[model samples]
Target: MTIQVGDRIPSATLNVLKDGVQAITTDEIFNGRKVVLFSVPGAFTPTCSAKHLPGYVEKFGAFKDKGVEVACMAVNDAFVMKAWAKDQNVPEDLMMLADGNANLARALGLEMDATAFGMGLRSKRFALYADDGVVKALQVEAPGEFKVSSADAMLESLA
Candidate 1:
């Protein structure tokens, strides 16, 4: 089953590009923090590049003001995620995380098989409000839909 509100984040390594090197961990990122974590199907995909990520990028400052640290995750490698973040003009404030191995996605039970699309394992689109690593709110989109769980909707929930 998919993860839900009040669920504790599974401890798994995630690739985070830092200072020209890759840092791997699950502890420092979410532990003891108020985090807004969102996942997309793939890196540089149409809707994700165009809308999903941009929405978070645009509202990152507001989210910070509300004491939420923002993170975007995809099943791509650290290099691709870092490059895509630059292409998307993702500011320094928002973290672009690489779930290259899909460990985190699988742990959360949000892994989706896209081998038919020539993409291997990937994450379903979703967002969560997590406080100290425990989810407070969770939103998972219906397949191929983007109506809810948007940054705006999550922000409104925080209000």
Candidate 2:
């Protein structure tokens, strides 16, 4: 079953780029915080690059003002994620997390197979409001749709 609101996020390691090195784990991120975590199918893809991530990047401050830490995760490696963040002109507040091995995605039951597109296993597009490791709100897109989970939409939920 897919994860739902009130589910506790599974303990899994995530690849994070910091100071030319790799830092891993979910605890480092959600131990005791209110987080707005969003996942994309793949980095540099059409909707993900043009709309998904940019939406979060744009509203990052609003999230912070609402006491939410913003994070963007993809199945790509840290190098790719960091480069994509730079390409997207990501600011410092929005964290780019890498689920390179898809372990986290699989744990959350949100893994997607895009092998037909030359991309391997990846994450589906979704967003969640997590407080100290437990989910408070969850929104998963109905495959190829982007209606309710945009950054603005998530912010509206907090209001």
Candidate 3:
């Protein structure tokens, strides 16, 4: 079953590129903060590149305007995520997390078999609001869909 609202976030190590690759734990990322964590199936895919990520980038300031921290994750390596962040010209405050081994996906029971696409284990597109590591809201998109997981939708949930 998928992780539900009110569940304490499962512990996992995700990576980010700073100077070199650095491992960041769920505790470090989510503890004592209201976080908006959004996941994509892969990095650099058209929709993910042109839309999913940019939506978050465009709204990063607005998210902070409401006192929320924002981060985006994918099954790519820290290197790829870093490159994508630069390519997307994302701001320094909008973190890019790398679930290099799908650890977070497995922990959340959000793993998907994308073997047919040669992507292997990938995270279904989703977004959630968490307060000091406890989930407040989660919006997971249906397979092949992208409705409720947008930043606008996430911001709406806060209202």
Candidate 4:
């Protein structure tokens, strides 16, 4: 089922590129922290590169100031996510999570089939706010739309 407000984030392992590709579990990320996790269909895709990720990169500190650690997730591999982070000049603390197998998306019931577009299974564009593992808010965008899940919109929801 789709994760909802007050739901505990499901357990999953995702990759991040640090000294090398490192496996991070969901418990390590959401436990004892306020996190804002935003997902993209793929890294380096037009809208994701130009807008969605950039919005988070720009406002990362604002979210930090409010005590929320921000993370960006994509269904692409860790290498691609790392390259995109470097290309975007993403802040070190703004985690780049690679859900290469789309496991987490599938677990959350947010996986999208993009095989018709030549892209395989991917994540739907969405964002969620969680405090110490419990979801506080979630904003999932309508396909082909970008209104609700933007960093600005998520921040506003926190306010």
The lDDT per prediction is 0.90, 0.90, 0.95, 0.95
For candidate 4, the C-alpha RMSD (Å) to the true structure equals: 0.6
lDDT of 4 by residue, 99-122 (tens): 999999999999999999999999
Better model by TM-score: candidate 2 vs candidate 4? 4
Q: Pick the winner on lDDT between candidates 2 and 4.
A: 4
Model 3 lDDT tens row, 1-159:
799999999999999999899999999999999999999999999879989999999989999999999999999999999999999999999989999999999999988999998899999999999999999999999999988999999999998
Better of 2 and 3 by TM-score: 3
Q: What is the lDDT of candidate 3?
A: 0.95
- When summed lDDT is taken over every stretch of 10 residues in candidate 4, the lowest stretch is 140-149
Badly placed stretches (over 4 Å) of model 3 are none
Runs in model 1 with CA error above 4 Å? none
lDDT of 2 by residue, 12-85 (tens): 98887788747767877887999989999989999999999989988988998988999999998999999999
* Candidate 2: residue 88 Cα off by (Å): 0.9
Instruction: Give TM-scores for every candidate, taking all chains together and pairing residue i with residue i.
Output: 0.96, 0.96, 0.98, 0.99
Query: Distance (Å) between predicted and true CA of 158, model 4?
Result: 0.8
Instruction: Kindly list the per-residue Cα lDDT of model 1 for residues 1-159, writing each as its tens digit.
Output: 777888898889888787875766667888989999999999899989889999999999999899999999999998899999999999987888999989999999999999999999999999988999898988889999986778998998888
